[model samples]
Target: MNKKPDYLAHAVLLLGMLLFIFPIWVTFAGATQSAGAINRGDISLLPNLSHLGIFVRAFSFGSGLTGSAPVWHMLLVSFGMAMTIAVGKIVISALSAFAIAFFRFPFRMAAFWLIFITLMLPIVVRIIPTYSVMSDLHLINTFPGLTLPLIASATATLLFRQIYLAVPDELVEAAKLDGAGPMRFFWDVLLPVSRANVAALFVIEFVYGWNQYLWPLLITTKGNMDTVVFGIVQMITGDQLIPWNLVMATTILALLPPVIVVVAMQRWFVAGLTEVDK
Candidate 1:
């Protein structure tokens, strides 16, 4: 059975969809033209097969990013950074959550609150001190430098903690009776049970890491270490004459990985986010 849609709701939805898609459509259209055409403010919604070579150029050779490394290399770096951040966040958050949820210790609440408090202080706020620490450690221009500072995630820990809290005490008792140590219980029981949440959080953290700009721009002195996200910014180095075609190509490339992750895992991602199991 179908019901008639509210006109107001339909209008609002259409408007929102247009707002979301207009920029992307414009980018796709611009990506198929010459830099000169785009620079001249002449763009149309027609595909230019001749301009397809621009994508090849952007991939095989670097564009306006002033980097000798190709866009593919930047993609690889972004993928590595994103994966490291996602996995690191999950591992640390899971362990921290397990400790807080299952163990009774001195200052446990204090430690949890301290970590939670950090959620208020974004990376921007601590950039100076964080950069100093990274510099002192000689991590600048390094992969670790780009990622390690960003891995401390209180939100993931909180999410996992909430999930763990919802688990039944009977499960723990059953595992205890089966001679399962804390590590054994966590590995064999909790981890398996939390797979959906892990996948969900992976999607979130991966996108966050991939989209990072300011930190990567600051830490990576070498052009080779730049991420695809920053690579796009470098394409428009100045307002004098922007390379719109190449910029659009790079933008599309940057959008693909996260988009693929979301599309491929939309089922599990949505489920995990909306329905945490006990």
Candidate 2:
């Protein structure tokens, strides 16, 4: 006989999903309403479909609250930075982990431990010195400056190292017997095996870079280089009246890219997190 469904678990999951989604629904509803209505506490559960053009307006013209740059530009900057940081972190971490896992080098464990130690000291702790270094390198007010400092990921390195270590020694011996060199083996075998983990890490790191506010704030001095998060903050904190509708619309737009990434990579991301073996 077939087992019955777990009603309690289903109910709990539905509740949790609604709890998470309700705020987004409210935001979207508010976004489609008038600023006057939202400011006057006339928020509604149902969105006004006629006002859907607000999203287009917000993306094209911005809120005009603080003479901020256009939303499209801000979005482009954020997207580029997020992509660069994610890919950079993955490549560097994968290489470093591969070296530490497969090759016996001088002070190898010491190097791995050093990378791991940096995880405890997050960006906030080293912001000052990091800024100084970036300034010294003459990378201020640039995209490279915005993304470079955030690229190194000790956590990714550690995860990749563990994955590499889990590879069977017999496989390594077989590769050796096949005359596969280091780079050859890494390209042919290790990378394919680590694909899921890479996808999961990319999602995580992309969100991390996309949501970055403080570092971008410090590094970028030009309005043209401002990220979407920074522009959103600027829209809120200005001396002029806050356009709640426009702000809400912009917020909704800002949420799209990362959501698309997560949804698009959902399968690989889930597999990466849950799968035990390559």
Candidate 3:
């Protein structure tokens, strides 16, 4: 017998999608309108194509009156920070998980538990101490200071540990019998098998870094080092009249990188989260 269509499910999904897309559409439309109109709460649902050049202007000079760094520069800083944090977390977490899962060592489980216990400690609890340490190292206002501290993630380590644990013992035995050393096995066997999980984590960690406000706010004292999220806030909180059009345009631009990453890695992300055969 043929299966019936799930109309109710489709309708609910469509409603949810519309709910998400509505605000984004409004923002895009507002970006194409005049600042005064948006300020007067006169945003239109449809964008004015004639005003499309506003994006270029926004990208080149975001709220120029505030002496803010250009949108492009802020975006570049965020992208670099996000990439560094994501890759650093993956590499460090993977090695840590590998050691914990496969190797015999002193206090290995204890070490893993200690790392895992950090998950219970909110980042706020560590900020003052972390800042003091960064200050002592003379790393404040530096790019490394902005990213290095955020790289060690208990969640990523836990996820990686789970993935490593799921690897069949037969595979490890076969690799050993084939004379594959630890590093060789990690590079040749483990890395390839873990590709999907890596992609998923990259997406998560990249977005997390991109949207960071509090830590970047503390670490980056200079305007030039500001992330896009920080720049948006600066634009809004300036002393002069708010430029709603520019703000909306910058918001749209800030959203693109994460969207592109998710779209590009959609297949791998889904596989990593849902695949059972692995």
Candidate 4:
């Protein structure tokens, strides 16, 4: 028989859930509160529904709080850059993972190890060098510069590799017997089998791209190309005082895309992780 749920484990999980959720709750409440209330640190458990105008003002970029560029344009630029990175990363990482996991080649293990070692290296350590390279390539302040370096993540490659490894060897052999070439086998057999994993990877990659701040900040110095995060920083740092209500509202808006993706692709996400175990 299966063991009963442990009371301590349940309690710990409940505590963790609250810890994670409390900040979201606070942010929502803060978005609804008046500027005075936020600045005064007036804590409220529930949203101040009477102050719903704050969200509307924030969404419309009509909030007099920040005289900087419009929030809508910043949002669009950020989304564009994020989508570019996400799509590029998914395509490149998936193909590379498929090749490394399925094919035999010279220095295969060494190559895999070299890529995987990036997982252990801190991103900050490479920022200066990456920036210098981008400058040399005349990519500074360009969208491509912001998106290119992160086109491959060690984590995504590792996840896809594990998923590929779970594929049945017979499927590969059958494809070979049917006169399917390596690329065809990869496209037809392996890819179809790993659809859930691919969807999961796309969602994960999208979130990483969307939330990327430091690199985008470094690469995009122009106001026109500024990402939402960098734009928010600019909003706060400008001559006008920080409007916590508007800030919280914009933050919630920024979070919506990733949240929607996770909610929509939840089944694939869970399945992707579960399949790796088998």
Candidate 5:
């Protein structure tokens, strides 16, 4: 006989979905309402359509830092930095994973474990040393300083390594037989076969870079180099009393890029994680 589906599980999942979505719904509702309405917290169920001016004011408000701190410029800088980190991380970590996964060499296992050990240490533990190195290199308050320390993560390398391990040995052997060196094999075989994983990593890393506020705020003292998160923070904490409606609107805008990437590339992202599991 066909078994009945789990009604309890379905109910739990439906409840969880509503719980998670409720805050986002509230934020959207608040975005449409006045700051006064949000403060009252009474209009939680429906958006106050009477005050659509909040979004307009948020989008149109010029950055009080300087006339140049436009919303578009903040978006561009944030996207650019995130792209750089994503690309650099994927390339470097993929190469490292390829070398460790396929090669036979002295201390290869040791080196691999060393990379894995880095995963245990939080970035907070390394910040002082990393900052010292960046300062000595005169990269402080610069793009390189912002990115180089965080461009490659051990977790990314580990993820790629697991994905590479799923590739058939015969293909790598065939490449070797053809006298294709490591770089050539990686470029031609591993990368193409693992493109889904790469895409997944890029999306994940891009979101990480985009949401990174503490590190950038700590490193970048200059106003022009500030990222979108930094800009948003400045908006909230600046001399002007933070317009709550505007703050929520800007927060929503800042959130869209990563949300779009995840929604658009969700299939590949899931495929990559599943591949790693195999």
Candidate 6:
């Protein structure tokens, strides 16, 4: 038998990687050029070293003639919202999954299925009713309001449930033998064991919450509450001579934190996704 590598497969993957990296390269190059150079079509694929000030301004102040809050504030709100959503989903989903996985109760399957159904429903589908509920609860312009409605998710719960189910019942038995109650077992054993999974899921859920636009725009009427993702876009959407270089600089700033997070947690994240406890 002859063994040969698929050169075509490698070529295709190489093409895909280039396709992904191309835009990022272009954005970085654009950030270094002046707005006049970009508008005049004098832009080059190679990044110029002359325009570091664009970044400083982008980091130091809000965009333009309007008295919008600073970019730093927008970034702070974005990080705060992302952290809240990631942690919120993990806690709620863990408790819900723990109950569904270990307990024998009436309507247990029904409850699990209900949560699973939420995965089928897109946030846009329920936006109006969700907004109505938020309004009734007077949660608008609040951090909880920005995050809580979006936390109506089932993915993390489902992931946690799978991990819990795969854990040996012997651990529960051992805990019981050791006179550990449910809460104690959870705090002492289950949570510690699930740390990798939680870290993995945090990276994902944080990105999801950070990238949210529509719901945040709808609920956040105040300029100060605008997230970096939305605020940066709002800078260039009008019929004005927008500062393209500054816009690109803000884009780079917006992408950095999440990229840093993914890079930092990559080892644990890969493990969490791949490993199934026995």
Q: Rank all candidate structures by their TM-score, best first, as comma-separated numbers.
A: 3, 2, 1, 6, 5, 4
Q: How accurate is candidate 6 locally (lDDT)?
A: 0.87
Of 1 and 3, which scores higher on TM-score? 3
Summarize candidate 5's per-residue lDDT along 39-134 as a digit string, tens digits.
Answer: 676556687788666666665554477643655567777888898999999989998998899888899999999999998898899888888899
Clashing residue pairs, backbone N/CA/C < 3 A, model 6 = none
Residue 145, model 1, lDDT? 99
What does the lDDT read for residue 102 in candidate 2?
96
Give the candidates in order of lDDT, highest first: 2, 3, 1, 6, 5, 4
Look at candidate 4 and give me any clashing residue pairs: none
Writing each residue's lDDT as its tens digit, candidate 4 over 1-278 gives: 99998999999999999999999889988999877788899968799899877776776562343244567776787778778877787788778888899889999989899989999999999999999999999999887898889887878788778878877888888888999998898888877888877777777778888888899878876766766777777666766667888988887787787798889999998887777666
- Runs in model 5 deviating more than 4 A are 40-44, 49-57, 60-68
How would you encode candidate 3's per-residue C-alpha lDDT over 1-278 as one tens digit per residue?
A: 98899999999999999999999999999999999999899988999999999999998866454356899999999999999999999999999999999999999999999999999999999999999999999999899999999999999888888888888999999999999999999999988988998999999999999999999989877878889999999888878899899999999999999999999999998998875335
* lDDT values for all models: 0.88, 0.92, 0.91, 0.81, 0.82, 0.87
**When superposed on Cα atoms, how far off is each prediction in RMSD?**
2.1, 1.6, 1.5, 2.7, 2.4, 2.2
Give the worst 10-residue stretch by lDDT in candidate 6. 60-69
Better of 1 and 5 by TM-score: 1
lDDT of 1 by residue, 1-278 (tens): 99887999999999999999888888888999988888788988776877777777667646444444678999999999999999999999999999999999999999999999998986788999999999999999999999998887899999889988888999999999999999999999988888899999999999999999999988987888988888777767754577678879888878889999999999889889777643
Which of 2 and 5 is ahead in TM-score? 2
Model 3, residue 238: displacement in angstroms? 0.9
Residue 227 lDDT (model 2):
94
Candidate 3, after superposition: displacement of residue 257 in Å?
0.3
Top of the candidates by TM-score: 3
Q: Give the Cα-based TM-score of candidate 6 against the true structure.
A: 0.93
Identify the leading candidate in terms of lDDT. Answer: 2
- Please identify which of the two predictions, 2 or 6, would achieve the higher lDDT against the true structure: 2
